[model samples]
Target: MRPQTTLRRLAEMKAARDPIVMVTAYDYPTARIAERAEVDMVLVGDSGAQVVLGHDSTVSVTVDEMLVLAAAVRRGVRSAFVVCDVPFGSTEVSDEQAVATAVRFVKGAGADAVKLEGGGAQRLSRIRAIVAAGIPVVGHVGLTPQTAVALGGMRAQGRTTESADRFVREALAVQEAGASAIVIEAVPAEVVDVVLPQLHVPVIGIGAGPADGQVLVLHDLLGITEGKTAVFVKRFAAVGDAMLAGVTAYAAEVRSGAFPAAEHGYPASADAIAAAAAAAAAAAALEPGQIAD
Candidate 1:
């Protein structure tokens, strides 16, 4: 078994200019695959709302649902760091509420760290409280999905001078608020370049260009998600097509009665068949007239 990845190791990797790799995973199989692939981190992201649970948006998922997904991922991960996303409402109530939610992920789901979206005042409070409670926190900024509506839809941030400045401010504030790492999503690469030097902690990017590391949705990268994906997603394997082809072939075989052939069936002894036939014949013969002795 591989040793667990620690916060110190992650920091060292960032210092050494080694790019970290992170992927989203919602369940055991995906988590196991991520571990086997030797990715640096596995995030049980709220994006699972769309990818796994078929929810329309991340906000629709609840803390209990996230806990279920996080725990399953935790069971399959051996070496990679496992970070669970605190869902939309999980941390919005108050710092105390945030600590409670983070505690559940650590105690119930075995999460190595918890990720909370946004870098507003409330968000920083949550990050600080969770960290004070002895649980590591990963801060998220730049086009937070939970409040995408307020951000004027699911679009890239930092396009304008004002927005770019705010983006940089939020990123730095999140790092100062006790986050061990930060994830920036859907922001311009140039803005991230400007903000990178100001940050001492590892910065993982999604649509936000190169940082200390990068993360992409597992389904998006593996070609399992149907239809359009974000610009940052690059399909590495057509797993969806392969799955469809496999099922289609199995269906065709079933229709043609090509499955369960002689080799697929269990062998039966001729003597046992004969004995069974004899018993059936005797039973039939005596049924109408008398009970068998």
Candidate 2:
């Protein structure tokens, strides 16, 4: 089944019991290619600040930077829903300020929706304001990276009964406040499982698997990012290994002078050779005093 209208397709996928597969995409080529390859959603994630520009975390990504990538991804993607993050500190402003900033992602960046970190903490009124303004929102919860300093590293959330209940409450509130979807990240599968049955909107998982669908960091899945994937993250492709093999082969051929074989070498051209000899004579074998002798 084709997941076309981001929300429509997400709902359809949920009904079909097919897990949605969303991936982070920062630019046009990746977005268009992913949409053509038929992925459900293209997330212009602020992670670009890390993966592309070598930032420390999503926090360091500016709203301007996110919009730049979002627009690029928007131009590339068609059919699948394109969502952009509000980036850090953009939504913590007034309700009017939040909507105004989110509008930039849609109008300036061509995103279909905006995603904001944190569900229950500080400014849920802003989420409602944006949705009320007719912009779709994808709520993020359970280990929001925008709050990483407070969250304290990559730890599983909702481990305790109270925390679990809080996670559920936040998820439900976000959905009720009109989030088209929710991204459960870096949380236990149990947290995902508990929420899946409870929410009407589709649950797109990152570290959470087999929920309504799943999402991943594009670089990690493609093995372009150098590191081991988490236990929760599954590998559909070994892009890193494949890339290594490809580069290794190319390097060896180049070093051994085995590359640029007969076919790759320039075809012998009599005109080209004659032109080169004329250039060589002009450059070398000069009569030292010919100009004034």
Candidate 3:
């Protein structure tokens, strides 16, 4: 087996200019795929609210829901560093609440680190609290889905001058608060480039362009999600089409009675067949009102 990826290894990769690969995985199968693909990080992202659980937004996902997903991903991963998203409301109330939430992910889900969205003052305090509690943290800045409504919807951040300045400040604050790594999403590449020189930790870009690493939702990359996706998402495989085709073929076969053909079944011994025949005969001989022995 390959050696498990560690924070030290990730740091080395950043120093060596090796792009860290991360993917969000919600369950065992997806996590197993990520492990087999040799990804550097596996995120049990709150995006599971929309991707897996059919919720409309990330905020709807609770800490308990995230924990279940994180634990499942943990069971399927052995090599990649696993980070669980501390869902909205879990950490927003108070620093103590944030620490408790982080503890749950570490103790219950085996998360190597917990990721928190936003880099505002409260968020920085929460990051500090979680880190002080002995849990590593990955900070998220730019277009945080948890508070998209407040940011004027899920759109690209750092596009305006003021927005760009805020983005830079937040990203730096998050790093200063002791985040082991950071994820920058939906920000202009130019903005990210300016901050790259300043951030010492690994910076994983989603829609923010190249940095120390990149991450994408597994479903998005695998073509499992329908309709339009974000501009940054690039589908690497048509797994959804393949799945549909397989299921369509099965349904057609089932409807036409083409499935469960003679060769599809197990063969019984001659003695077993004879015993079944005798049992049928005995049943047929039973009186209408009598029970068989």
Candidate 4:
């Protein structure tokens, strides 16, 4: 088995200019696939709310639901570091709430670290609080989905001067608040390039351009998510179409009575069958009012 990926190892990779690979996984099967593919990180992303649970948005997912996903991912991952996203309302109330939620991900689900969205003043405080509790935290900035409505409906960030400045400020503040790494999502690559040198922690980019690492939603990459996806998503495989084809073939076989053929079943001895037939004959012969011995 491969050795577990750690924060120190990730930092070393960043220093060596080796790009890290991270992917979202919601269940045991996906986690196993990620481990087999040799990904460096497996994130139980809140994106599972839409991709797996059929929720309209990440904000609708709760901590309990997130814990279930995280724990399953942890069970299947042996080497890749597992990070769980603390759902929307879990940490917004207070710094203490953030710590509590982070602890649950660490203790209850065996997460290597927890990821929190945003880098506002309150968000930085939450990051600091979680880090102070001895849990490693991954900070997220630029197009935070939990609050995307306020950011104008999931568009790319940092295209304008004001947004670019805020991106830089938030990115730096998150690093200063004790995040071991940061995920820069849905921001212009040019904007990310300018600020990359200013931050010390490894920056994992989604749509924000090449950083120390890159992460994509597993479903998006596997062509499992139907309809439109983010601009940055690159489909790597057609696993969804393959799955549908496989199931369709199975249904056809079943309808044709081709399934469960003789070869697919066990056989009983001739004597055994005869004995069962004689027992049935005896039972059928008994009178309606009488009890059979």
Instruction: Write the residue-wise lDDT of candidate 4 on 1-293 in tens digits.
Output: 99989999999999999999999999999999999999999999999999999999999999999999999999999999898999999999999998999999999999999999999999999999999999999999999999999898888999999999999999999999999999999998988999999888889999988999999999999999999988999999999999999999999999999996899999999999999999999999999987879
RMSD of each: 2.7, 3.3, 1.5, 1.9
Clashes of 4: 0
lDDT of 2 by residue, 222-280 (tens): 76776666666566677778889999999999999999699887786999999998878
- The alpha-carbon root-mean-square deviation between model 3 and the true structure, to one decimal in Å, is 1.5
Q: After superposition, how far is residue 168 of candidate 2 from its true place, in Å?
A: 1.2
lDDT of every predicted structure (CA atoms): 0.93, 0.82, 0.95, 0.95
TM-score of 3: 0.96
Q: Kindly list the per-residue Cα lDDT of model 3 for residues 1-293, writing each as its tens digit.
A: 77999999999999999999999999999999999999999999998999999999898998889999999999999999999998889888899999999999999999999999998899999999999999999999999999999899999999999999999999999999999999999999988999899999999999999999999999999999989999999999999999999999999999999997999999899999999999999999998987889
Which pairs of residues have clashing backbones in candidate 1?
none
Higher-scoring candidate on lDDT, 1 or 3: 3
Collision pairs in model 4: none
Ranking by TM-score: 3, 4, 1, 2
If scored against the real structure, what TM-score would every candidate get? 0.93, 0.87, 0.96, 0.95
Q: How far off is residue 11 in model 4, in Å? A: 0.5
What is the alpha-carbon lDDT for the whole of candidate 4? 0.95
Q: Over 4 Å off in model 1, which ranges?
A: 271-293
